[model samples]
Target: MSISLSIHGAAHTVTGSCYLLQSGRTRFLIDCGMFQGSKTLKALNYGDFPFKPEEIDFVLLTHAHIDHSGLIPKLVKHGFAGPIYATHGTIDLLSCMLPDSAHIQEMEVSQLNRRNVRRGRPEVTPIYTVQDAESALRAFSPVTYDEWIEPAEGVRARFWNAGHILGSASIEIELTTGLDSPRLMRLLFSGDIGPEVTSFHPVPESPQGLDYVICESTYGARERPQMTLASRRDLLAAEANDALKDNGVLIIPSFAVERTQELLSDLLALAKERRIPRAPIFLDSPLAIRATEVFMDHADELEDGEAFRHAMRSPLLRTTESAQESRMIERIDGSHIIVAASGMCDAGRIRHHLKNHLWRANATVLMVGYQAEGSLGRILQNGTRAVRIQGDEVKVRARIRTLDIFSGHADGTALTQWIEDRGPVSRGIILVHGEEEGLTALHDRLAKKGLDGDRIFAPELDAVFDLLAESPSKRERPAPRRLQPEVVGQLDWHNDLSRLWLDIEEELEKAADDKARRVVLRRIRRALENERS
Candidate 1:
């Protein structure tokens, strides 16, 4: 009787979190998250699962974040029919999130196909449709936090509140071979643990007695400011006041889940006290509006219930649902705050808003969450003078501000303390859900605390940890597989050149006449020749 853990995704990257645990005759998955960020990483979403999804017994979801649960629909579409277990809050969030994700895919593919038709290229189908997402929702089985359950043979599992988002959790699983076997293994998967205290969600509880722990290191190398939620709110109010004084549009690219609710709560407080002007506050993403309702439904379970109620009832918070309503927002002429999704600004209505307002000197773009490398938000955060949005280069004259207090993940100090609280154990501590540098920093920190080098693993993508079959003391470090010769991404010249050529082709297709098309081509050719010179 042996158990093995396979790292499918989020091994050394911040997104696409999937893990497979095979215990004796039973097989199950913890997460089936979608790959996001770079084109190379996002391209992995189109590839087949390394293992057959139908063979898995069940899925144990840790949260409802798209990066953690986004690929569940794809799994179901690929023939996985087992129950997908999660907390009630996560289940409820998924009810809307999955459908929204599917809708985004539908919209993106529709746009891409239109271009493909014009260019005589083959049309591509969406990875999964809205119907597939709806079908996936039927498989959810809600479980209560802090209760143990046997979802499959020889496996017992429990969920603890992780304080990351609404109903987010860290899962603990114990597996035993048989009554005669002396071997019993326990594994803990930290599903995006949050800070010590959050205004929106309750603080997470640290669990002990784990033989092996799989933890996240998203902020393993950075420390957050020691500020209370009230102070953070004060800062937000100051920013709003400044934006209002400038008489410019305030744009916020916010996550559609917990971050939206938190921001709304603070804004509602500001509105009550008249700290901000009586301007229209638009919640532009329909997905966010639905998620806010879910937050409202679970208000009693949150930390600041009264605040949540006040935020939900705010009259200034307007929601735009239809295409016409969204378009109408672009035409409005006034000092207002618009919160849109695809938090990183890679997709969604935020791109449209950024295109319309980013060039205005009076506009302000407030970034409120983690922006992965190569994301448009990161580009703005890095102080890029201009950015390409939906095929047009937009000058970034608008002020870009990042409020780190809104982040849900715990920082370096909090993460270290969480790891230390686990008590002394001679077992493996596997790091995932972070970039290489952050993971290395965390691994070094753990080593300084007396954890042996052999016991600490920073797994590469697709690396496997054979838990039951091999002891940490005897197991050798896993080598990374050759996925490619070198990393290919937004900075890769080949990728950039291809994209530039595609943009030129699209612009030519939209030209009114051959003269205009020739003008476009000549400009491109001249630009290339100038670059060569």
Candidate 2:
């Protein structure tokens, strides 16, 4: 019997990575990630799994990024009980990140319910709770890199450092039939491969001898400009000098994982060399601080392990763990740098920081990571004059800047080089976790390398291709009804209108007299009437 693979998620987008593999009686999954990006994409998170969760044997998690591992709690909550295998570094990071993800879900649900209660709408529970996340954690089985193990019957797998994050890895699986059969298959999954190298980690080694390859093309259409560690420090110093010109707050909205730690190292290096002033630096996200500790625990996996450990203890750095402490940061006077989480500014304490300082001309929000399409960070990056945060309209007067040196994913050129180094594949390549443009560009490059057009497959959402078949055939199955993008957009607009109406209601309630209330209500009515007309 031949092993068959199904492309479940991350086929035409950059998030929600999941794949189903089947071999005779055994079935397994890889990367049960949460969908992210525009509201249309995020709705996929609440949809049913393509395959029954309870039927899968186990999950092979690539890394701990929410885009890659956020749905583990939801998976476990849906009745999955098998082991979730990952690298040692990934396991430690998950220990902190999963609970934080659960907390965010609970808080979001609570906030929504508060509004629902006032609006007479039914309250909705979170997709998964903290207990669910904790339960998922119990199923994790940590394995070191370069070691092979049998996660399921008749299958062997190994993890190779992807250099994307602290414990990120590219997985290799070898499947064989019965002892009497001579057929065997080797499959490789590139789980968000990192760049050539970062300040914290060395370049990832390419895996060889692959029968088939499932790869990511997140940055496949463009190449990153060359930047060295020294240049990266210089760029940070320049941004700091510009932002701190008049004792201003320099806010860096970073991801809680590798990005935050990398920024800390660069900032500390700059301060130590006197290239930048020794400003008060606050690590504001509780999740990021916890992940930083995990980085410390696995310092040996980093490039300059000793330097990373020392930088975490720098006098210029302080961590804010509690809500009270986070609020206390606003009381801090003078030039200071605050690094917070939810890099996209979609959630977390970064919104609080943005709300407080975004209106100040002297403040600056330095973006050091990729911001998804509908994220607040992207809106700011696009130079929006105003944004609604926590139902309050916040002006955007703060200086906004971005430095690409901090990105963990490889560029198009780097990805091409890595693929070239990985040698030839006997079967074919399936490109996932990228947009259409990137996928097309990468596919063209692969075609030039002798891969035929028919062999390079880029499936759409829910589209499946059987790997073990004689030729690629679109699976014929009953398609489930999914909300159309237009419908999703309409729903999003409704939510926005509801929030605006609530803001108006609150304003009217605060009015001092009947006349004032009448004026506010009239304005709201007029605005709605004008919109209709």
- lDDT of each residue in 300-365, candidate 1, tens digit only: 888768678876777888999987899998777778889999898988999999999899889999
RMSD, candidate 1, Å: 4.3
lDDT of 2 by residue, 335-396 (tens): 99999988989889999999999999999999998776566777788887667788787768
C-alpha TM-score for every candidate = 0.91, 0.90
Clashing pairs in 2: 200-303
Give Cα distance to truth, residue 472, candidate 2, Å.
Answer: 4.1
* Global lDDT of model 2: 0.83
Error of 2 at 160 (Å): 0.7
